[model samples]
Target chain A: MEREVNAYKCRKCGTLHYPFRMVCKNCRANDYFEFDIEPLPKRGKLLTFTFIHNLPAQFEVARLGLGIVELENGIRVTGQVDIEDPTLGMDVVGNVEVVRHDTYDDRYGFVFRAA
Target chain B: MRDVYIIGIGITTFTRLEYPLSEIAAYASMGALKDAGVTDVDYVLVANMGSARINNQSALASAVVDTLSLTPAGAVRIENGPASGASAIKEGFMAVASGMHDTVLVVGAERMREVNNLEATDFVATLTHPMAEYIYGVTLPGHAAMFTRLYMEKYGVTERHLAMVGVKNQNNAMLNKDAHLHQKITMDGILDSPEAFTNNPWVAEPIRFFDCCPVSDGGAALILASKEVAEASGKPMIRITGIGQATDTLAVHERPEPTDLMAVRIAAQRAYEMAGITAADIDVAELHDAFTILEIAESEEVGFFEKGTGHLALERGETAIDGKMPINPSGGLKGKGHPVGATGVAQVHEIVVQLRGDAGERQVKDARTGLACNFGGFGNNVVVSTYARED
Candidate 1:
C-alpha cells in the first residue's frame, strides 16, 4: 500500500473523519473502533494558498507547493499543488503518493494536485 | 457575582534571553507578589501554550509551583494557543470570586526561543488544521498574509496603512525599557532598510516580518484576590468587572470573512454585557497585536471602530496612547514581544498598570476603566477582559 490514499470512519454518528481523530468531534465516542469509509472526493476548490520560500529540510523538494483546498463537499484539506498559478477558488484534485519518510512503512499519503 | 480585583502585575523583560523558562516564571511570580505586597497565595494558575513543543515537557504547572515554593494549594496549567495568558487569568478570577481561594497568582510564560525559528513556526502551525493545514505545511504568518491581502482588496487598505501600526507600536516600545525591540523605525526605514530581512523580505505577502510579532521568551504574572483580600493587601484595586471568551473555527478559511475575526466580536459583546457598559466606556486598551494588521482588525472587530475603519484609525492617530483610545501602551506584541502564552496575561498586566495610574510615561491621563482583548490563532479562541479602578 505504498503511496495509497486511506479512509477513516467515525464509529458513532456515522460521520466519517478523514485522516484520523482521537475521538469523533461530532460524537464524543472515545473508542476509535476503526472502520473504512469512501475515499475523500478528489475535486475541490482552492480556498486559499501560500508560497513558502522556507520549509522543513525534508520537504525542500516540494517547496512553494503547499495549499489548502475546500472540496465540493466542503471538506478542507492541505496538500501540494502540482503547478504554479495557484489562485483562490481554483479547482484542484487529490493524489496519493509516497511523501517520503512516512511514519508508517509501506504507506502512501494523500496530497493535492491541480485538477 | 462576587467582587474580584487584580491588585498588581509584574513581567520579566521580553527578549531573546538564555534564562531557563522556570527561572523566568519565578522572577515574574515574585515580582507580581512584591508589587501586590503579598507573600503567601492560595492558588497559582500557569499558562503556557506549548512547552511540549519548546521544551518537550508538559509539567508546566508543577514547574511554576515548585519554583515559587507555593505548595499544597490548587495549581493548574491553561493552554489556549496565544490566548493562554488571558484564559489563565479568567480561571484565576473565577476561582477567587467564587471564594475557592483568597489570593491567586496567575503567571503566563513561554520560552519559544528554546526552539529554533522553523520549529517554533511549525509548532504554532499545529494550532491550525493538523491533518489539513500543518501536515500539508501552513504557517500562521502565511494565513495572516492571505487575510491581509483580502482585507486590503475589500477595504482598500495599503501597506502604508499597515506600516503605521508598526511605527506607532515601535515608538511605544521605545518608551518601554523591557520591550524586545524599542528602536523607533520610520515608515521609510521599514521600507528602505536592506538589513530588515524579515521586515520586508516577505515571510508572507502583505505581512512582513515587521508586521508580525517577535517569537519571544518571557513571562508575566498577576496577583488577583477578592476585594476584601485586595483591600487587606494594601494594593491598588483594579476590579475585574467583566470577562468574556468566545471561539471561532480553528481553520482560517472556514471563517465567514478571512479578514473579520468574529470571535473578538462575540467576546467583546459578552464582556460588555457582563460589565454593563459599552465600548465607549473604555479609557484604554491593550490589544493582541500579534501582527500589525491584527491590531487594526481586532480593534474594529471589538467595536472600537466601524468595520473597514481600523486602517484609518491608525492613520489619524486614534489608536495612539494620547489619542481617543490608547492601544498597546506596553508596545504590543510587535515591540514588546509575543511570548505566546504570556501575551494574554501581559495584556491584562498592562491594563492593570494603566488603570492604577502607574504606567509612568505611557500612562493615559485620567484613566479609569481599562479593556484588554487577546485572541488565539486567527481568532479561533478569544478572551476579552475589562478592568476598573475602585477609586
Candidate 2:
C-alpha cells in the first residue's frame, strides 16, 4: 500500500495547508476540510536544495538530497529529491516512496524526481 | 520599573566538560558571586536546554541552588530553546526592575557533549515542528543550507563571502581563552586550495563544515542588581537598558517569505525603541551565528545594513573588530562555541567584558553600547537585548 500526500483547506479562508493545521493562519478559522490531492499534478518547482552529508545514524546512505518543492497548487512541501545536480527553479514530480528502513520498520515518505 | 545593572559575570571554558551538569552551573555561579563580593542573592534563575532530555536530569535549578549552597533563595529554570541564556537574564532583570528582588543570579549551562554528535544533532532538531519539519528529517544544518541557497540567489552572495566570515571569526577566537575552536582557519585552507574540498567537506550543501558551530558543553552566569546593590559592588555600571522578544511561525515553510527574518526585525526594533538608540549608536554587537549565513542575514535584519547589503559590508571590512561597527568580536557562536543554553549569556558576558575594557586582544575600542541577539529555533523565538556602559 502506497501512502498518499494530503493537504487541508480552511473552510473559512480557503487556504490550503499540508500536514494539517488546526487553525487558519490567515483567517484564524478553527474549521478545516480534508482534501485528497492524489490526482493533482505531482509537478512542482524546486525552490532550493541541499546534499545532506551528515545524518542521524538510522540509515546507511552516505548522503541524501533534500529540497523544498512548491506544488502547482502553491503549497510548498519538503521531501527527498532523487537527483544529483539539483538547480534552482527546476521542475520536479513528487511520488510516494519509501525513504529509509530503520531498525524497527520501513519508513515511507514523499520523494521528488526530475520531471 | 527600577533600573537594573549587571554587577558580575562568569563563564566556563567552552569545551567538553567532564563534570556533572549541576556542577557546571555551580562553578560559573560561584565565580559570579565571588566577583560581586556577595555571599547570597535573593533569587537564582538557571537557564538550560536538554538537561532533562540529554542529561536525564530535571529540576536543574533546584540541584544548582543546592550545589552552590544557595538554599532558601528562590530558584527557577528558564528554557527557551537556544535563547534560554538571555531569557534567564531577562527574568532576572524583571525581578530587579520590578523591585521584587534587590539581587538576582542568572546562570546558563548545557552538557551537549554528553551525547555524541549524531545524537546532539537529533537533540537540537527537536526544536523544529514535529509534524512538519522534524518528521521529514529536517536538521538545523539542512534548514540553514536551504536558507543559504535562497539568500545567495536573492542577494548575490557567494561562497567567498561566507568564507570571509569564517576566517575572521576563527581568527578572533584564537584570542579568547574560553572559546571552543582555538585553531585559526584560512581561506586557502578551507576554500581556495585544491585539497579544500576534502579538508572542508560539505555537511550540508552550500554550508561547509567550517560554516557550522561546534557542539559544546559550558556554563555562563550574570548577577543582576538594583542601583543600590550595583553601586555597592563598586564595579563598572553596565545597565540592561533594553529587552525585546518575538516569535514567528513554528514551521519554516509556513512563513510568508522564507528569506526574511521578520521576527528578528521586530524584536530588534522593539529593543532599539526601548533603549532610545539606533543601529548607529551601537559600538559593538554579538549576533547569533550558529551558521555563517545567519550572521549576515541577522546583520541585515537588525538594521546594521540594508537588506541584501550585509554581505557587501563584509566585503568592505565594515564588520571587523576595527571597523565602523565591530560584530562578534568575541568570535561569536561560530568560534566561541554554542552550548545551546549558554550561548546567549556568553554573548552578554563578552559584551560586558568589552564595555569594561577587559577583552584583552579582541576588544572593540571604546565600546560604550552593545547589542546581543539570541536566536532560538531557527528564528521561531528570538530575544534581542541592548546594554550601555554607565560609567
lDDT of each candidate versus the true structure:
0.81, 0.90
Q: What is candidate 1's lDDT per residue for B1-391, written digit by digit as tens?
A: 5899887689999998797887788889999999998888998999998887678778788888987888876789899899899999999989987887889999999999988887788788879866455655567887777678777878988888888898899889888887899788887777756755545666666567678888899999999888888898788878998999999877665554566788899999999999999999999999998878889898898899999998988888999999998899889999999999889988888888888888889899999998999888878899999989986
Across residues B1-72, which tens digit of lDDT does each residue of candidate 2 receive? 999999999999999999999999999888888888899999999999999999999999999999999899
Deviation of model 2 at B254, angstroms: 1.7
Best prediction by lDDT: 2
Docking class of 1: acceptable
Q: Give the candidate number with the greatest DockQ.
A: 2
Alpha-carbon RMSD, candidate 2 = 1.9
Estimate the TM-score for candidate 1: 0.89
* Model 1 bad stretches (over 4 Å): A1-38, A61-63, A98-115, B192-199
